[model samples]
Target chain A: EAGVAQSPRYKIIEKRQSVAFWCNPISGHATLYWYQQILGQGPKLLIQFQNNGVVDDSQLPKDRFSAERLKGVDSTLKIQPAKLEDSAVYLCASSPRGGGGNEQFFGPGTRLTVL
Target chain B: DQQVKQNSPSLSVQEGRISILNCDYTNSMFDYFLWYKKYPAEGPTFLISISSIKDKNEDGRFTVFLNKSAKHLSLHIVPSQPGDSAVYFCAARGFSGNTGKLIFGQGTTLQVKP
Candidate 1:
């Protein structure tokens, strides 16, 4: 079975520029998630989508970050006016369901470097 | 607040020895715990998981032990191989008022020498 797929793999952008990352979840997966992993830190949940509907995005910075899963199969995360602090790896993950106790499958991630 | 924490940043062990990674969580509502292995430039892969009701779960040479009373958990690898060298992350599920989100630790980088 194929795992979650992400685009770019690596990206570089200047501060104040806009950047977008794409994610395609595993086949038949019902839940998708976006996370940010800074250097030396664990992945931090940015947003979650359950079949095109947002399940949770409380930790996301509404002022600069936004994410959407329009058709439920693919999703995109965008950051506008990127700051130096936005330099981190963006990971996408999927699961069979959106409930607890299910293991999430992760993608290779997009490493974003904001200069 | 950081709910989950891995105090050790790195560990080194010889091949065929035992590798123990520890994790502590402050939240009592976590219903599930998981360990993920990650290599440089690669995403984390699910290694093993254990539910709160079960104290121990083993898969191959990897064993996870949970202590609810102390809110601590550990991942043990026996006869560790060189391929086992990677960053191990401890994650917990079931945050109150959250929807199936996982809280992860800083991770511990393990090195198994040949």
Candidate 2:
């Protein structure tokens, strides 16, 4: 079975420039997530989607970051006015369900370097 | 607050030796724990998992032991192979007013020398 897929394994952008990342989940997966991993730190959950509907996004900086899942299969995460602090890897993951004990399958991730 | 913590940033062991990685979590509500292995430039792969009710779970040469009283867990690899060299991350699943999100540690890079 194919795993989660992401586009543009690496990206470099200037400060204040906008960037977007794409993700395609595994077949029949109902839950999708976007996470940010800074240097030397664990991946932080930014947003979660369950079948095209939002489940949680409390940690997301709505002022600069946004995400959406269309048709419950593919999702996109966007950052506006990117800052130097946004120079980190943006990871996408999907799961069969959005409940406990369900393992999340991750993608290769998009490394965004904001100069 | 960092709920999950992996104190060791890295570890090195001989190919035939045993490797033990430790993790501690501050949240008592975390009911499930998991370990993921990751190579540079690749996504993390699920290694092993154990529920809170179980103290130990083993698969092949990997074993995960959880101590609820101490809120600590560990991953053990025996007769480690060179291919086992990778970053190991400890994650915990529990409801924190949000969906069941997994809190992860800083990750520990392991090097299994030939």
Candidate 3:
């Protein structure tokens, strides 16, 4: 079985520029998530989608960050006018369903560098 | 407020010894806990998990112990090998309706020397 897939394994952009990251979760997965992992820190959830419907986005920066899962299969996370602090690895993960103890499968995150 | 924390940033252990990585969480509503291992430039992979109802869960050589009263959890790797060197993260899930989003702690880096 194929694991989660993400594009643009690495990205470099200047501050104040716009950037976007994409993610394609495993087949038949019902839950998708986007997380931001700064250096030396664990991942923080930015947004979560349950079959195309957003379930949680409390930690997301509404002013600059936005995410969408049109068909619930693939997702896109965007940051406008990126800041230096926005430089981090954007990881995408998915699970079979929303429940306790369900293991999440992660993708090779996109390393974003904002200069 | 940081809900989950791993006080130790790094630890070194000799091969064939046991490596214990500790983590503490502040939220009492957290009902499930998990451990994830990550390598440089790669996403975290699930290692083990334990429910709040249970104090211990073991899988192969990996074991996780949870102390709900203290809000502390730990991961233990026996007979540590060089391959076990990586960053381990602790995650917790709160009982917030249908949202199962996990809150993670700062990772602990383990270095096992032969």
Candidate 4:
């Protein structure tokens, strides 16, 4: 089976510039998630989508970050006026469904470097 | 506030020896816990998991023990291999008004020497 797919494995942008990351989850997966992993730290959940509907995004910085899963299959996370601290790897994951113990399969992630 | 924490930033063990990584969580609502292994430049991969209903769960050479009273959990790898060198993260899932979301620990880097 194919795994979760993400684009632009690496990215670099100047501070205050806008950047976007794309993700295409595994086929038939009902739940998708976006996470940020700063260097030397674990992945932190940024947002979750269950079939195109947001399940949770409390940890997301509403002022600068936004994400959307259109058609429940492809997702995009965007950051505007990026800060230096936003330099981190952005990961996308998918599971069979939501509200269970199912394991999530992660993509290689997009490493964003804000200069 | 950091809900989950892996205090040990790093650990080194010789090949064929045992490796133990510890993690602590402060949230009492966490009902399910999981361990994930990650290599440099790669996303984390699910290693093992345990539910609150059980105190211990073992799979092959890996075992996870949970102490509810102390809010601690551990991962044990027996006869460790050099290939096992990677960062290990502990994650917890609970009803924080969101059923499937997970909170992750900072992570512990384990280096197994040959």
Candidate 5:
């Protein structure tokens, strides 16, 4: 079975510029997540979606970050007026369903470098 | 306050030796814990998991032990291989009001020498 897929694999933008990352989760997966992983740190959950509805986004920077899962199968995370601290890898993961104990499969992630 | 913590930043062990990675969490409501392995330039891959109802779970050469009272967990890999060299992360799932998200700990980098 194919795993989660992410686009660009790498990105670079100026501090004031905007950037977007795309993700396509595994087939038949019902839960999708977006995480920000700074260098030397673990991936931090920025947002989670159960189908087309958002399940959690408390840790997300509401001022500059936003994400959406249009059809509940694919997701996009965007950051506007990016800052240097946002220069981290954007990871996407998905699980079989929105349930505990299910292992999440992750994508290669997009390394965003903001100057 | 950090909910999850991995005190050891790195560990090195010889091939065929046992490797143990420790993680501690402050949240007692976390019911499901997991371990993920990640290589450079790659996203974390799920390695093993344990539920609160159980104290130990094993998968082949990998084992996870959870101590509920202390809110601590450890991942053990026996006869370690060079391929196991990577960063390991521990995550927990719990509900905070209306949201249920996995809280991750700082990773522990492991190197296996031949």
Candidate 6:
């Protein structure tokens, strides 16, 4: 089976600009997630989607970040008026249903660099 | 607050030696623990996992030991090889219905010398 796929392995944008990242999870996976990994830190969960519905997004910055999983197969994460602090790698992962020790499969991730 | 913590930022060990990485978690709700290995420019891959019900889990050269009383878990690699040089992250799963969301700790970078 193929792994999770993401677009634009790398991106560069200016401060106050807008940027979007897209992710296509593995086929038949029911859960998807987006995370941000800053330099020298662990990846922080930004949002999680179970099928077409959101399961958790409490840590996400509502003012500037938003994400959606349109048909439960693919998802997109957007950041408007990007800040310098937002410069980090955005990772996407997917897992099967029922969640009984199912390991998540991660994508290559989009490395966003905000100048 | 950082629920999970990996105190060591980096470790270096000679090949064929033993490597031990430690992690501590403050939350008692975490019922499952996992370890992931990551290479530069690549996403993390699942290495091993252990449920709170079990104190230890081993696969090949990688072994994970959990101590519920101390709220600590550790990964030990025997006969470490240069290919094992990478960042290792510890993650925990909380019991919140079907969320299955994992809380991760800051990773430890391991360098194995030949």
TM-score of each: 0.98, 0.98, 0.97, 0.97, 0.96, 0.97
The whole-model lDDT of each prediction reads 0.93, 0.93, 0.92, 0.92, 0.91, 0.91
Q: What is the TM-score of chain B in candidate 3?
A: 0.97
Which pairs clash in model 1? none
Q: Model 3, B1-114: lDDT tens per residue?
A: 899999999999999999999999999988899999999878899999998999999999999999989999999999899999999999998755777778899999999999
For candidate 2, lDDT tens digit of each residue in B11-99?
99999999999999999989899999989999888999999999999999999999999999999999899999999999999785767
In terms of DockQ, which candidate is stronger, 1 or 3?
Answer: 3
**TM-score, first chain, each model:** 0.97, 0.97, 0.97, 0.97, 0.96, 0.95
Residues A25-109, model 2: lDDT tens digits: 9999999989898978888899999999998898999999989998888999999989999999899999999964547999999
Please rank every candidate by DockQ, starting with the best: 3, 1, 2, 4, 5, 6
DockQ for the candidates, in order: 0.70, 0.68, 0.73, 0.67, 0.67, 0.60
Ranking by lDDT: 1, 2, 4, 3, 6, 5
True contacts kept of each: 0.68, 0.63, 0.74, 0.65, 0.65, 0.49
Tens-digit lDDT track of model 5 for B1-114: 789999999999999999999999998989899999999988888899999999999999999999999899999999899999999999999886755678899899999999
Candidate 2: how close is chain B to the reference, as a TM-score? 0.97
Could you tell me how far off, in angstroms, the CA of residue B8 lies in candidate 4 after the best superposition?
0.4
Q: Model 4, range B8-101, lDDT digits (tens) per residue?
A: 9999999999999999999888889999999987888999999988999999999999999999999999989999999999999867565667
Local distance difference test, candidate 1: 0.93
Q: Give a tens-digit lDDT track for model 1, residues B34-82.
A: 9999999899999999999999999999999999999999999998999
TM-score winner between candidates 3 and 6: 3
Least accurate 10 contiguous residues by lDDT in model 3 chain A:
A96-105
Show where candidate 6 strays beyond 4 Å.
A98-102
What candidate 2 gets wrong by more than 4 Å, as runs, is A100-102
Range of the 10 consecutive residues with the lowest summed lDDT in candidate 4 chain A: A96-105
Best by lDDT: 1
Candidates 4 and 5, the one with greater lDDT: 4
**CAPRI quality level assigned to candidate 6 from its DockQ score:** medium
lDDT of 5: 0.91
| Total backbone collisions, model 1 | 0
Clashing pairs in 6: none
